[model samples]
Each structure stands twice: as structure tokens, then as C-alpha cells.
Target: MIACNFSFHYTSFKCEKNFGVFLAVITIDLTSISVTSAVISMAGKVMKKESLSIEGKQGEQVSLLIQNQIKKLLSLFENEPIQIKAVGVSVPGICYSKTGLVWAPNIPGWDNYPLLQDISYLLRGKNIRIKIDNNRTCCILGEHWQGAAKETKNAVYLAVGSGIGAGILIDGKILHGFNDAVGAIGWFAVDRTYKDAYSEKGCLESLASGKGIITRVKESLNIIDDYSGYFKDIKIQNLVIGDVFDAYKQKDPIAQKIIRESVELWGITAANIISAFNPEILIFGGGVFGPGIFFIDEIKSEAKKWAQPLSIDKVKFSPSQLGNNAGLFGAGHLALGRF
Candidate 1:
């Protein structure tokens, strides 16, 4: 059985079966749950509405929160037999499947954490199994399961959000490098010679990520105000990439500059991926892609300038049809493949 705020799809099994599997490809929404008393108390005074940083103890608190969420999900299947086959989870980070360690920068303390073993221990004696994968690989798997990449054996899915990453599928298999960081493109440097005033080298994320857009805007305008204009308000603490797109639509000079630079960076990255991987299709996903679609033609147009002429001509680009559900679907596929 699979459940989410969006929908629930359940499968029935025979009573003779003593085991079953539960797969979840969902993003962890931390804000929706309440933190522990200690965390809440520590967060006092320093915790701003939009930006709240917690200390190390928060990791255990978050682990408890996740355990509860999983319990709640498991409770839904109470009516059925208690046996469970396996649970496959897709997260937003570099997952080491062999050791079941997950390194997610966004989630503190998750770095090199034994997520699978821990979760399995939590479900011990339940006659169930658990597995995990990164969101990028899951996204592409979801697309292939029922979305635009259904028939393609070799494809790439780019997820552009707070950070940018890619999922590469070649010859119908997910490619995970030795360290399981094959698709981590955020660190891909665009400028070989360019370095930050602070001495940081060329990170693709510095130029193409959502944070990158805001940073660029700040550099250009030298204004500390949050992003606010025609399309959106400055309610959020920092400006998101969407605001940049809104500004572009309204013809804001700063927004235009940011878009032009960001798009070019994306094009260059795409060209490099195309040349290296030679994927048949390139699918774009994530929140940033919402505004990115409006600039697809421009992205492609610029990509043609830098991409290998033949390589660029062979690849097809399109938006992700699965949207947010791609990860969930992919998790299900991963679970299914386990059998």
C-alpha cells in the first residue's frame, strides 16, 4: 500500500503470504511536523520564521519525526497481513546502497548515516524489508515507468531546484559511480580559470542553482532587500529562482541579466553532459523547471552554440511529465524490481 497527501493506491495479497513490501519515493517535509521539546526550546529567540537553524540534537529529533511518519504510513496497512516484503526509499542526496549510508547536505546529520539499517531496525520483527536510492535515480526511474522516458533506454533527467543535480540512465540501468555520486553536478565548475574573491573555484551551482540566481541578483543590484516585484512578494526570507523568472517576464533589467547568465550556464552544463553521456533524451524536472520551461527555447538555442554539433543534434529535450510524483513512482519501481 502507498499513501500520500495527493492519493493512495493499494494492492491486495493472499493470506498465505507472510511478507510484503512498502515503497515510498517522497520528499521529507520537515516543517509539517513538530520538533522535540529540547529542539524547540533551543530554537527560541534565534529561530526566525523563514530561516531556522537547529543544533546537532535536532538530528535525533528529525529521526524521531521520520520514524513517526513511517509508522503512520505503516498503520494504514493494519487491515492487511502484518508481513512486509521490502521498503525502498528515494531521498534527495548521495545514497551509498552497499552500506546503506545517505549523505544529504540539506538534511543535517544524514551525512554517511546508516539510514537503511536504522530504518530496518525500527521495523524489526515486522517481517518487512527496506531499501533506498537517491532522488535523481528514482526520478528517472519514475519517468521511465510511466512518464515521458517510458520507452527510452538511455536518458538523463535534470532536477533544478534549490540546487541542481542530474540522474543518468544508460542502457536501461541506473549508473552509480564508485562513491555513488555520479549525478552530483552541483560541484561541476564552469570556469576553469575563474575563482571567487574568497578563492572558490568554478562550481556550476554558483551560476545555475536557485541560490545562484539570488546571489547573482545581489551582486548585480547590491541590494539586500528580498525579491519582490510584479509577480511575487518578498514574503520568503530569500528570493527564489521563480522570482527571477517573474522578473524576466516583466522585463526587469536585473532579472533579464540573471536569466541570461543562468541559462547560458545551464546550456554549457547540458552540452557537457550530452558530450560525456550521449543520452538519447534529456528531461528537465523540479520547481525551477516551472519557470525554466518558458526559457527552454532560449536554453536550447544557447546550447547549440557550445555543445558538440553532432551530440547536440542527437539529443531531445523536454519537461518532466511526472512532476513531483516521479520519485514516488520510481520508489515503487525499485521495490517491484527487488522481487
Candidate 2:
């Protein structure tokens, strides 16, 4: 048997089977759903159960891949007698709440695309309601929903990836500014002097992001007389995050200098987030932080310099427990409309 309750929070359908009740939730992460990738998963009451991926060039092929995977999940749930309570989707770019349109910079042809309508079209006869939001917001919400920030009303997730972004939760509500772009912290001005490149992705992001670290290293090497020590055999143009980390581990002077700057930038960014939101916990995640987790203590120590005296000491700084799955679970929480 199934019982459903409709409210502003979520339209939850409770499925009572012979042994227990199971609520099925579907979460789709479209961050990599471009000319090269996509990932979707299904979750029950506790954790993610299954997931699928798509890797190919962008075009009609990508659309078909998404639709086919969704259909398959729907069918799988239907056969298991599982009740899909809600569907939550996390987009890589800006998500217009009112119109369900998306503008993803990395995924071509998605500028203001009517993504919700397209998904709704696929479930024309179903009662499931879909909710969509940016991946940054999803990351924080995921933490609040089931990870580190659980039970906390105020928190922030500092996502340091190729670029920097943040997910803020204030007073138990996800903060979505007028343009639904509140967490685009990459553009935050943390530096006094600006350059042309800084204008492209913001001063903070251009200086502290993973790619930024690589760029700084490359530029530093070009101006110096030598790449002494472990950096001697490095290639600038092809430098990647792993290579930079390797160099850092080997105590390469250039890598050390660049990474030290990045750490300070991260700490400054954290201080800003702390001063603004006064969250209970400041969670760190994203690709850069995966290997860069070693710097958490230093980041915390640095944040103490600029953060609000009253709030800085009150908050906790920690790495994400959910890791890459933070956004996925956050999407599930969105579908359930639960804080």
C-alpha cells in the first residue's frame, strides 16, 4: 500500500510493503553531462542504490542518453513496487527556480534551456514533482541533509575544484539570491591588484583554484632562471593538478610558493564565508580538496586572521564526509523538500 502527503516541502508517497516502508528518491547530477559526461543515481531512504553514466560528445546524443537512463530508472522502480516520492536534479550552472531553465557554461546549447519541461515531458502521466538547483547549493544541502552539517541550521560548503564556489545554508534554508547565483564565490574580490585574467573568473578564483595554481606555477617558471630540484623536468603547458601535487610533495620551491599562496587565498575565502553566514560548520569538498585535504589545518589557521572574531571561533572546519556524493544526496533532499 502507498500513502502520500502533499505540502510545500515535498510531495512524499509512502510505500508500505510486507516488511517495511521504503521511499524511493531519484537524483540526477548534470555537472558532467556535456559533450563528454553525465551521472545519475537512485536512492531509497538511506543511501544511493544505483547509478549510471554517459560519456560522449554533446548534441542530440547527450539528450538521448539522459532520457534513456531516466526511463530505465523509472521502469526499474516501477517493477520493484517502489514509490518514487520526488525527483531532484543538480545542475552545474545557474538554475532559474521559477522557470526551471538552466545556463551551464561548460555544457554547450544549455543556455537558458527548459530542462524541467523536457524532464516533465518524459513523465507526462506521472505524479512525481521535480526540483532543481545548482550543484554548489546541492553540496551544502547534502551535508545538512545527511552528512557533516546534519541538525545544524547554518552551514557552508566551500567547494574548491577547478574553480571555487560555495553552498550556503542559513537559518535552515538554502540561500538563493535574486539571480539564484549567490554561491558563485569564484568572482569574489579577495585581491587588491587585479589583472585581465582575474576578470575572467574573479580574483579569488583566478588565484586560488586548481587551474589557477597550475597557471601561477607555469607563469612563475617562465619568469625564473631555473626550475631547480624536482621541478627541473616539468612541462608547463601540460601541467595538471596531479603533477603540481607531485612537485609539491618533492619540496619543489616553485610548487611550494604557489601552493602557499593558494592556501592563504582559501583561508581568506573561508573567512569571508564565515563572516557573512556565521555557519556552525564550514565543510570543504570538490576535486581540488580531494588531494588538497592536507591543507585543512592551515586553512583554518589562516581563516582566523580575517574572519569575524565572534563567529570564527564558533564554527567548525572539516572535510566532507560524503565527498563527491554530497551533491547527489543533496539532490535527493531537494526532491524530498526536507531541510
What are the candidates' C-alpha RMSDs?
A: 9.3, 4.1
In candidate 1, position 40 carries an lDDT of 8
lDDT of each residue in 169-200, candidate 1, tens digit only: 99877888877778888878777666663133
Clashing pairs in 2: 32-37, 35-58
lDDT of 2 at 100: 72
In model 1, which runs have C-alpha deviations exceeding 4 angstroms?
1-58, 80-84, 196-202, 223-238
Q: What is the Cα-based TM-score of model 1?
A: 0.77
Off by over 4 Å in 2: 1-21, 33-56, 59-61, 222-225, 228-238
Reference-based TM-score of each model: 0.77, 0.87
Candidate 2 Cα deviation (angstroms), residue 303: 0.8
The sequence of per-residue lDDT tens digits that candidate 2 reaches over residues 139-238 is: 9988886789887889899998777889988998888888788899999998888789877778887888887888888888878885576666765676
